[model samples]
Target chain A: SQKIEQNSEALNIQEGKTATLTCNYTNYSPAYLQWYRQDPGRGPVFLLLIRENEKEKRKERLKVTFDTTLKQSLFHITASQPADSATYLCALENGSARQLTFGSGTQLTVLP
Target chain B: NAGVTQTPKFRVLKTGQSMTLLCAQDMNHEYMYWYRQDPGMGLRLIHYSVGEGTTAKGEVPDGYNVSRLKKQNFLLGLESAAPSQTSVYFCASSPNGQGPEKLFFGSGTQLSVL
Candidate 1:
C-alpha cells in the first residue's frame, strides 16, 4: 500500500512569515499531486494541483513544488496571516478514477 | 452554487444502530467519493462511485456500504454503527474521473457512535 507522510503535526509561525509544509510519499507513482486547505469542523477545499511533469506551481501567495525523484512535495504560504491558520493536506492521484491518497496533514497557526 | 451537499450535518447513534449519509452534487460530476476523517489518520476513503450504478471500495470500506443509483447522488450506509465508527464523514465530487480535476467537497457530516 502507498503511504503518505506529512512533516509535522503542528506548525506555528508569525504573521507575514513564510510557512513551509512538507509531504512525502512511498511506493507509488502518482501522475499528479494536490493540496487542500481545511478549516476546523469543515471539509477540505481544493487549493492547487501539480502534475508530475511540472516542478512547481503557484497561485496567489501560495506555491507548491513537486519533486518526483524525492517523492516529496513542498507547500509554501508566503506572507502568512492569522486567517491562514488551518490544516493543509497533500494528496496523490492514484488512478484514472482520480482516487486520492491523502497525508495526515500539517496544522498551521499563524500568530499575529 | 451548492457544489456538494451532505445531509445530516451531525448525528449521534448507539452501537448496533444504523444510519445513512446522503451526498448530492449539483455540478453534474461523474465521480463521487466518501471519506472518513479521524484525529490522526488523514482522510481514509470508504467507497467511491465512478458513475451512475457503479461503485468501488476504497482504502477503508469496512463497516460501510455505498450506492450511486443516480448520477448526482451518493449514499453511504452504516449497517451497524460502532464506537470506532465515530468520525467526520466527507463527500466529494469531481467533474470527471480523469486528468487533474479537483474535488469539490461538501460540508462534512460529524458522526458520533456510542
Candidate 2:
C-alpha cells in the first residue's frame, strides 16, 4: 500500500516569512502530485499540481516541487500572511482512480 | 455556478443511527469522491465513483456505502453510524481522472456520531 506522510504537526512562522511544508510517500509511482489549502470547517481547495515529469510548479504566491527521486514533494508560501494560516495537504494519484490519496496535512499558523 | 455542493452542513447522530450525505456537481465531472478528515490522520477516502452507476471502494471504505445513480449526484450512506465515524466529510469532483485532475470541492458535512 502507498502511504503519504506530511509533517502532521502544526507549523508556526512569522508574517512575511516563507513557510515550507513537506510530504513524503512510500512505494508508489504517482502520476502527479497536488497541493490544497484547507481552512477550518471547510473543504480543501486545489492550489497547485505538479506532474511526475515536472520539477516545480508555481502560482501567484505558492510554489510546489516534486522530486520523484526522493519520493518527496514540497509546498512553499512566500511572504506569508496571517490569512495564510490553514492546513495544507499533499495528495497523489498513483495511476489509481479519480480519488487521490492525501497526506495527514500540516497546519500552518502565520503570526503577525 | 455551483461547482459542487453538499447538503446538511452539520449533523449529530447517535450510534446505530443511519444518515446519508448528498453531493451534487454542476460541472458535469466524470468522477466524484467522498473523504473523511480526522485530527492528526489526514483525509481518508471512503468511496468514489468513476461515472454514473459505477462505484468503487477506496482506502477506507468500511462502515459506509455509496451510490452514484445519476451522473451529477453522489450519495454516501452510513448504514449504522458509529462513534468511529465522527469526522468532517468532503466531496470533490473532477472533469476526468487524470493530470492530477484539478478538484472542485464542496463546503463539507460535519458529522458527529455519538
TM-score for each candidate, following the candidate numbering: 0.98, 0.96
The true-versus-predicted C-alpha distance at residue B14 of model 2, in Å, is: 1.7
- Alpha-carbon error at B94 in model 1, in Å? 0.3
lDDT string, candidate 1, A1-112, tens digits: 7789997669999999999999999998999999999999889999999999999999999999999999999999999999999999999988746789899999999999
Span of 10 residues, lowest total lDDT, candidate 1 chain A:
A93-102
Q: What's the CA error at residue B98 for candidate 1, in Å? A: 1.7
- Model 2's CAPRI class? medium
Please list the C-alpha lDDT of all candidates, in the order they appear. Answer: 0.94, 0.91
Model 1 segments more than 4 A misplaced: none
Q: Give model 1's TM-score versus the native structure.
A: 0.98
TM-score of chain A of 1: 0.96
Model 2 Cα displacement at A109 (Å)? Answer: 0.8
| lDDT tens per residue, model 2, A5-40 | 999778999999999999999998988999999998
Clash pairs of candidate 2?
A: none
